[model samples]
Target: MNIVACVKQVPDTEAQIKVKPDGSGIEEGGIKWVMNPYDEFGVEEALRLKEKNGGEVTIVCVGPARAMETIRTALAMGADKGIHISDPAFDGADAYTTASALAAAIKGIPHDIVFCGQRAIDDDSAQVGAVLAELLEIPQVTVVTKLEFAGNSVKVIRPIEGAQLLIECPFPCVVTAQKGLNEPRYASLPGIMKAKKKPVDVKDAGALGVSTDRKARVVRFVPPPARAAGKIICADDTPEGKAAELAKLLREEAKVI
Candidate 1:
């Protein structure tokens, strides 16, 4: 079996991003990049499945040339190889544009299954996998917490309101992974060394006959409004009194009851 995982380069969650002078985008300077958290789970799941069943795991990503760092990280994590689709025009594209471009990119290869994260940390739109599935005309399951492969078919487990649902789809399906699916591993010394020798092929979306002139432009990015500060309201001094006061206050002020 041949499996492909989609990865992305996203801003480090610890880093503080600065806006551009005119409020168009984030300031590129001093911005550190890392693999998207969701994508990491997808990669880990792919590697785990391949390790268990013995298949080739390939990583695919679309970003600037700097994205190779993320690809290399996945390589160290045990993907067999990688494909990088770097195009200047794709930089500001939205989920629609991204999925379309990736669909065109995959047109050049034959894949048995495709895996992606539930969403990118930066954007968190959480729609690319489904859009790609529509473009490819294949079945897709999102927010999957557990997965298993059988003869020419795959089963996925997704969580709903206080319940889990099991669904089955044919082979050559697309899956978007959710967190808690597995514990991700760090690359070892030997794996890092081997990553440097792994094959990574790069392609430009525009050069690959993929159109960049498309819909979805970034108008601007603004930070969310600050959260309100905490307040401590003292209740009765005794434990029982405090519990009663807390329940009363919650029902009245917080409106939970």
Candidate 2:
């Protein structure tokens, strides 16, 4: 079983993020980068699969040079090798373009199963894995919380609003892992040292033969407006009067009634 796990680099959730004054993107100067949390679940699942089936787990990533750090992070957690897809042409790429590059790399490799996070925490698009599956012409299961392996097929459980759906798909399929899939393991000291020696094949868009055309693009990024201070309703002496004042404020000032 040759398992391919796709990972992405994203800013730490706790990092202080500030938008560029030009409304272009976030300020990356002091941001701490890490592997996307959901993607970590995918990597952990891949490692578990490799452990059970006795095969190699390859980490595939699409990002700039800094993304190699994330790939090595996966390696430290027991992935065998990594493929880093990086290029200037891929800058500002949309989900379609991103998935295209991933599909191109996967096409050249032996992949019996492919795993990806349900969505990248940065963009929250939740489209790359499904798009990659479509480009590969293989079956795909998204938002998967549980997985079970059979002879040549895999069963997955995905949750809906109030119920869960159990789906079965064959090998050579794509699965987007959800949060409940599994707990991610931290890399040991020995594993961290070994990861530094692991081989990572860096490929460009041209090398992958993927087009740079973007089906969608982010024109601009604007920071959310600063929240306003809450108003105190202490003007009214009675509780009923305070409730009436609150309703009036909601209907007039807040306009949320």
Candidate 3:
């Protein structure tokens, strides 16, 4: 089995974000980057599948050169190698453009299964994996919480509004991992040492023969408005008086009742 895991580099979830002075995008200075939290689940699932089925796990990422750090993190977590798609043309590329580039890269590699996070935290578009599956002409299951391999088929369980959905698909398919899929393993000392020697193939949009045209563009970015101050109410000593005061406030002042 040859498993491919799609990962992304995103700003650390806890990092403070501020809009650029020109309202074009977020300020990158002082912003720490890390592997997308959701993608970690996909990487962990791919590693588990490789361990069970005797295959190599390949990490794939699309970002600037700095994203190599994210790829190395995956390698340190047990992926066999990595593929990085980085090019100036890919800058400001929308989800479709990104998926097209990734699809081209995957086409050049041998893969029986592809794993991706449900969505990237930066954009939260959640469109790349499905689009890649469509471009590759393969079936896909999204938001998979549990997965099992049976011969050439895979069974997966995913959550819905108030229940779970069980799905099955054959080999050469895509799977987007959900939060409960598995716990990602931390990079050990030995793994980190070995990862330093792992091979990472870097490719660009032109090399992959994919177009970098973006179908959409961000017009401008605006920060959310400041929050309003809270109001406090003090009432009389009697329980009935306090109840009346609360009701009056809710109905007239707060207007919530």
TM-score (C-alpha) between model 2 and the true structure: 0.91
RMSD after Cα superposition, model 3 = 2.3
lDDT tens digits by residue: candidate 2, 1-257: 99999999999999887889998888999899999999999999999988998899999999999999999999999999999999978887899999999999999999999999999989889999999999999999999999998868899999999999999999999999999999999999999999999999999988988898999978889888878888889756799999999999999988998
Model 2 gets an lDDT of: 0.94
In the range 1-257, model 3's lDDT, one tens digit per residue, is: 99999999999999888999899998999989999998999999998988988999999899999999999999999999999999988877788998999899999899889999999988889989999999999999999999999889799998999999888999899999889999899999999999999999999877889889999777787888988986555576688887888899889987998
Q: Assess each prediction's global lDDT (C-alpha) against the native.
A: 0.86, 0.94, 0.92
Q: List the residue pairs that clash in candidate 2.
A: none
Candidate 1 lDDT tens digits, 73-112: 9999999898898988888778988888788777667777
Which regions of candidate 1 are displaced past 4 Å?
227-257
The regions of model 2 sitting more than 4 angstroms off are 233-257
Which residue pairs collide in model 3, if any?
none
Q: Roughly what TM-score does model 3 have, to 2 decimal places? A: 0.92
Among these predictions, the greatest lDDT belongs to 2
Single out the weakest 10-residue window by summed lDDT for candidate 3. Answer: 230-239
> Which structure is stronger by lDDT: 2 or 3?
2
**What is the RMSD, in Å, between candidate 1 and the native fold over all Cα?**
2.5
Worst 10 residues of 1 by lDDT: 230-239
